[model samples]
Target: MSDFPSIPRLTSSKYFSSLLLLRNIWKGGDLSDDMQFQRVVNQRTYKGELILFAFDLCSVSDALNAVLMLRHVGFEHFLPLTDGAATCEALHALADVKALPTTPCFWSSSSNNHKGWDTWGAGAGCVSGERRRGYCKAEQLWAIRYHVAARLLASRVNLLHMDTDTVIFNDIYTRLKRKPISDYSLILLPESPVNGGLWYAQHTSLDSGAQWVIAEVARRTWEVISLRIRRRSSPPFDQAMLADALVSAMKGERHVAYMCEHPAVALQPPCANASQSRCAYRHYEWVVATLDARNATPLYRACFWRGDAIVTTDEHVIARKQRLVAVH
Candidate 1:
């Protein structure tokens, strides 16, 4: 886990005031709707209830299971993001309709978002079915999460961002409740150098500058996948981009840094807008089969995957996926 320095919390008064000010600044009294944009421009966060969420494009099973399993542990209302082509394709999977919270994710590239995230999300390795590292679904989801937390949900009490693939063996939220969310800004679990599988951060815990640093990192993730790092030696790829975001970026003289930190998360996909029920599953099979073919684990789960590859309950998943790839 990365070391975190102590910092002041946002305090509800300050944060709410900032929100009102932001509304005014952006709206400019143009009589815009309370929720300005559909796909993340001005969606109001449900700040009343402190939220817990995880995202996936090709990993709905994992995401939904995370929500259900977490309910067994501590988190009662964990949300699964309906972002990316996969989840949107599987919008009403099983009995998760009531349990799953609504989200304002762009999901697909339909919002006229010029980012062309759909193309950028696939990466070179994903297309070629090779083990070479190129930004893929995980980084895309992370970038989207960062945008939601910092931009839309900035006024929320706390956000517990978990990875869908993880099988929670312990009561993380119970342990987290030991301290107020403000006490720890960024929650990091031991063994995760990059993705942390799960992350916890309070809106108030971080200063705007620190938040922007992370936002910038997410933006950088959009660039074409490359083996070379940036001038200042930014993290090698999207994984490293997140690590640096947590640490802080050297953006000119306004160096924003993390205000609070904790050791607490395990780190652990995307698709086009084709609406076939099997769209996401089909894409995910090829994407993950490549990793399995190479016996590779993503950088986010390097330690955990290496440790747990032998004894596993999830072995069946990969087996099923591999078979799926072979057939269609």
Candidate 2:
């Protein structure tokens, strides 16, 4: 196991206040129809509680704005995870969510000038399947290793890990239920069976069963990335690592559950007006423009086509662009 340190607890009121201000600035001066938005948000935010973990790069305004929009629609309790004092304060100001300290990340700006780039070590040779691009291999190894360690150290906390690009349209907790008291140990993307897009786990105590599963996955990802280190330079295929680990865990003694749901339909691009249940799943489908042929970003126009079109967006291009630009 890697010896990366776990995230330290925060003790600064100043830092907390700053994150709060940054959050407020991100919100701008928009009026919220709490009732209307709440109706939409209520589906996910039940009293049992759900935690949203978004990893923010330099600025988290985009993800936090997603939280605010979810709140205006009526879902609250979105948390922003950060690695700096300034970032923490900025996020807190904009929303009534928790601001947790950042854990060890894949690569900070400082590593750009480091010597490990060209050197090969056991760390560099971990990739076993498809090769990975340069630098990214080391990054995946470090990220998964550190994140697992951090989760181990955080007592009594259940973590839900998410990338920054996603937005929440419903109360995520309500959809996930396993006997109510014992929630799912792992929840993953439905489209991808082998890999997980989101992860849910209790961090207070290490489950030997769970640890075995996490470690195996991390190891597989490292192998896939490292095997290619001698060939290609860099690859953004961390998801593949996740897939390998998850598949291994299922095959092993510790059978962690993977849940897949049709991501909420109302969250889809506006023009893809297809009903939620009717949507189909399409892999790696990219459209430069919407089905209507109007302009849209890859994600807004691009969709995972399920039978009839399960996942669609209603957000216009201008508004989505504004949201993207408004992030700090």
Candidate 3:
């Protein structure tokens, strides 16, 4: 801990309290959103027991490529979204046969939210249809959905939000001495687009400071910006939001470290750590078909909810089996 400069902890501010009060009026009950958002900010102080991660279909072909990589590497304890039964079935079937480690966590927002709810209701009106289509109409929308999915999974499991394109270069569990389980309370990966994208947490305090800034920004911009800035033609919108949050969290901090090896320096992967030899995580650069398609390869598979396969219903046999048979 002494290796990094110390930083101030996040406490409930007057603005946070006012936001909570307004949230109560906007809805009812204990204001779960505020509470949860605060929980993320507050939980950052505690050590996380799990390494949670999330990703969405980059493309049918891109997704298929990722799934193929999953075949080589197994993820039995991570939570991911698969709203469609056909896709879920295919995923489970492949994992079951391959004996790939699979967890019981499967989340879908579409099925969870009740129909006929208010436009701004709990889950009914999450993202406006117009905003959804216009913001990044060219590219697919998957980042924010995973954000909600991360929070939902946080109810039971500590999350490690991973993009579909990312791959573990080493045995992260043994290297970090932390299982991908919910024990530390809260943890998150670091990101500063200006430097590079690195997914590794050396200490809980960084995550704490990082999350504080992100949650505050989220509350402030939820209504106005929806946390997605599209002023430029091309930029990682979600990453920008997260970067803003990280930048905000680092304010007036002494011990806090932000990806970079030295304090107050630009953000970069902390390869100096023993855990990360070269890079803890590697993100495959997004590529398109070129003159030589031979270099390109499919990595994962994902079925969109709008597709016909998503329309078909299928039973979860693996879940049933996991329930019936105890792995001793």
Best by TM-score: 1
Per-residue lDDT over 40-75 for candidate 2, one digit per residue giving the tens place of the 0 to 100 score: 123222342334443333335665554444334333
Cα deviation of 248, candidate 3, in Å: 1.3
Q: All candidates' TM-scores? A: 0.46, 0.40, 0.38
The numbered model that scores best in lDDT is: 1
Question: Judged by TM-score relative to the true structure, which candidate is superior, 1 or 3?
Answer: 1
Q: Candidate 2 versus the native: TM-score?
A: 0.40
Ranking by lDDT: 1, 2, 3
Model 3 stretches with alpha carbons more than 4 Å out: 1-71, 82-105, 108-146, 149-158, 178-210, 213-221, 225-236, 252-328
lDDT of 1 by residue, 48-139 (tens): 32334545444555555554454333333233443444344453443245544332222322211324433444432121112245434554
Quantify how close model 1 is to the true structure by its C-alpha RMSD in Å: 17.7
